[model samples]
Every structure is written in C-alpha cells, then in structure tokens.
Target: MHSQYKSRQGHTTLGNTKTTVAAPSWISDFKEITKMRLSISVVFSSLVGYLLGVDVIDFKILGLLALGGYFMVGASNGFNQIIEKDLDALMERTKNRPVPSGRMSVNTAFIISSIFTVLGIIILYSINKQTAMFGAISIFLYTCAYTPLKTKTPLAVFVGAIPGAIPFMLGWVAATDDFGIEPGTLFALQFFWQFPHFWAIGWFLYEDYKKAGFFMLPTGKQDKGTAVQTIMYTIWTILISIIPVFGFTGTLQLSIVAAILVFAVGIWMLYYAIRLFKLMSVKAARQLMIVSVSYITLVQIIYVVDKFIR
Candidate 1:
C-alpha cells in the first residue's frame, strides 16, 4: 500500500524507434527512499515545536529547524529502509523502495543517511545543545532500537513513540534552552497521540505489514483486545490534550471552552476507535485514520490558540 507503482502510458507502436523520455532512475530512487509524505509529517511536528517554543518567532531559526529536522528524519527513514530492505521486499507497499527496488545501492543510501544525520545534528547544535541532544537521541532510538525491533514485538510502537514525540519537545527546548513543564507538556501531547495514529495505520495495513513480518498491533491480529487498547489510548490522548485547562501545567493553560472543544475532537476520534473495537472492521479503521489525523492537527491548533488567548 505504501509503494504505489503505476504503469506508463500507452505502449510504443511496433517498429517505433522512440525511446521513453524518462528522468534518471536515481531521481525516482531518491524520492522513493525519502518517502516525501512521511518526511513532511515529521518536519511538520518539528515546525510546530519551533513555533510553540519561540517567544519571539525567528524565521531564521525556524528555517534551520525545518531543513535540519527534515534531513534528520529522512536520514532515520533511510537507515530504516536499509535495515528493513529484506522485509520491505516482501511487502507490496514497500517493495519498490530505493534499496529494495535496486534503484539505489545500499552503500549509496548509507552514505546519504550519514551525511544527513551529521549535518542535522550540527544544525541543531547551532540552536542549542539540548535540541541537538534530543535530535541525536531520536535518531539513535529510532534507528538502533525501534527499526530492528519491529518484527520482534508490537511493543516497538511504544518504544518508537519516545523518539516520535521528540520534535515537539525539541521546539520548547530550543526556545527555553531548558526542559520544563512546557516541553514536558508538548512531549506528553504528542506522545499519547502517536498510539492511536499508528494503530490506525497498523489496522488499515495489517495485512501488508504482516506480509513484511511486522507485528504492529498488540494482539498481532486485528481483534477486540487491540481495538479496545487503541480506544483506551485515544481516551488518554483526549484527557492529556485538555489537561492544561486545569491551570496546573505552567504557562500552557487551556480555557474551559478550549478544553471542551479539544475534548469533543478527542471524543469524536475515540468514537471510531470504539467502533473499531466493537465492529472490528476495516471501515472502522479507515474512519479512525481520518479522525486521528484531524485530532492531531486540531489539537496543535488548539494549543497555539490557547497559548495566545489564555
């Protein structure tokens, strides 16, 4: 489902000497390896972190984080591809990745990943040591631990959430130069959200992932246990999203109205998760995916609005 390939237009006529005018395979290969959508989503979180953290919005620092975070995330993904090349080949969705498709050499991919990782860390270091450290830790955990553990256990999603949530926290640290309630709050927000988001994807692509030997769900099979757990996490996500309303999480305070709005969105998302638990159908998973996406975007927007309003 991930690596989608479409056939070219009409076949050449017999005796036609026209060669297909296509770009270099390497160009396509890079795109496949980078996974543009995923890299963009990762960088979006980094940008959100930067926006939330900076008291005085500095476009220059924001630019640096965006570019640097992209490379950092891309590097992690590239290395992940290399590690999972074998398994990826087994999955229809992943079989066309750069390494798996033979469009890029493994050495080439590794070199590119190394360059990006080093450059990303250096750029983050310019912002602050904490930012750089978090970036480094994210890449390390994602690549060294989470990537390899995918096939072994579903708990890997839990482990993966640690690195996954770092971008938002990284933003706060970049601005404050220290980790505190603000960064902790942002971290918690993203941390809990990942569970439902990923589980939805896992549910939708359960068959595809299983083909690749990935145990992405807690129950391995898409069952009530897994769906109920997904619903529980979504409930937790909703609870954490509105916690700032209680006026206890330092400067990040959400008003009653904002909390209610956020809670409504959470409940909306949880509806699908609960449905998935009860019906255990792909339709429920699809609905949850839509709701999960809406949940994250709305939650972040609410956070930004609450910060200015409250």
Candidate 2:
C-alpha cells in the first residue's frame, strides 16, 4: 500500500513539473505577440530621424520617442496578428504566432493592442502634436489598411510601405514639430527603398506567402518582370538617397563624401539585385534581401555620422 502511494506521488510531481515547464510567461507572450525584433527596427528608424532633425539631442525626448515608436509598432503588429490569425495558421512561417497557436486569446490580444496604441499616442503627443498625429496615422494605416489588404492584392506592399516609411520621417516631425522638405526627403528615401527589400522577401517566401494567399511581388509571380521592377526601384532608391548631396533637400544636405559612400552602398545593393535578375533563383533573391537590409542600415548610419562630422 505504501509503495503504491509513493508511485502515485511521483507521477503527480512529474505532471506538475511538466505543466510548469510548458507554460510561457506573460512577458514572453507579449514579446511574441508584439513581434519585438520588428518593433525595435521600426524604433531604430524613428531614432535616426530624430537624430537627424535635432540640432541638440535631448536624451529624455529620444528615449520617449523610442518608447513611443515601439508601442505604436507593437500595437500594429498585435492587431495585424489578431486580424490575420486564421491566415497565419495556414502559413508555416506564421503558424506558430501567439494568436494563431492558441497561446493567446483574441480578446486578450485586442485589449493589449488597444492599451499599447493609447500609450504610444500619448507618449508621442508628449513630444508634439504632429509627431503624435503621424504615429496615430501609422497605426491606423498599418492595422486598418495594410493588414487587411495583404490577402486581397499584391498592392498591399505599396500600402504597407506608406506606414513603413513614416517612422523615419516621424522622427523628424518629433524633433522639428513640422513637416517640411527635410522630413519629406527622409520619407522619399525610405519610401522607395521598400520595393527591393520587400520584393526580395516576396520572391523567396513565395511559397509560404502563397499558402496564406499573400502576393507581395508586383508581377504576382517570380518572373523576370518582377526582378526587373525590383532593379528599377533599387535604382530609384539609390537616386533618391543621393538627392540630399545635390543641395535640394532644404536643411538635410549630405556631404559629397557621404553621398559617394551612399552611392557605393547603393551599388552594392544593385549588384545583388542584378544578380537576382540574371539568376532568377531563390538563392539570388535571398542574397538581395540580405544586401538590401545592409544597404539601408549602412545608409542611415552614414547619414548620421556625416551630419556630425561635417
């Protein structure tokens, strides 16, 4: 009888241990739902904008801007997941997301998203009304327009780029509290950069995206047309990035050296893009995607560094 009791106790202990080990913490779930890494990248772009616009860097405002940007982007991502929960389950890449995987309830996710949205806007408002307005607009467009349009048409990439490009410009708004040629130039640079960056993603993830009825490429297929379009947009992105060096971007002028470096980075991106066009292979597309990310990151870094040095 004692032996039987001991065995039952052991079984109960093991069961409890397994249950405890399997349950994820609230923080982990929050991070997953918010797409933390993506949110951080968005915040980084906003920070770059703020740095470029401000002659005097206020760490307090900078911190608030980063926090605000993160919350807004987090809210957008959370709402997107909630809206696309069913579609997410169909795609292997998104199947394990918190909402679709049954780890988070829709009602709970919605509430969290709402809280973040309010918090984000309030924080941005602390910076300035224009900054807050742009943040709110970004959230609205991303959640309402971009999220829903994904499954309906490939034009979703174009719609999505609007909100994506806003972050960089939003920072300038936060700093200057005005939308002018400087912020507009920043917006144009990021606006055109999205094409090659996202099309490469679309090309490589064609199978996964198709599983969920998302067509992100312009031609709706991994064809030479899409590759050619990617090349064209890359050229546009390169051209726009160097416009500041020509003394046409108001107060946001890049030095000749900075422009040269930026052009070289653009060439690097274009080289990979051309390779993708020639090879028309998934591997080449993946390479372009990587180079595209590096290109933008390097360009932003060079711009900021040039501002300080010259």
Question: Which one wins on TM-score?
Answer: 2
lDDT of each: 0.84, 0.91
TM-score (C-alpha) between model 2 and the true structure: 0.93
What TM-score do all the candidates reach, one by one? 0.91, 0.93
Tens digits of lDDT, candidate 1, 21-131: 244344566666777677787777777766776678888888888888888888899999999999999998888777987767899999999999999999999988988
Steric clash pairs (candidate 1): 1-93, 3-93
RMSD of 2: 5.8
Native-vs-model 2 lDDT?
Answer: 0.91
For residue 80, give model 1's deviation from the true position in Å: 0.3
lDDT of 1 at 137: 98
Q: Over the stretch 1-310, how does candidate 2's per-residue lDDT look in tens digits? A: 2223323432333444653222334556777889898899889999999999999999999999999999999999999999999999998888877789786799999999999999999999999999999999999999999999988888999999999999999999999999999999999999999999999999999999999899799989999999999999999999999999989889898999999999999999999999999999999999999999899889999999999999
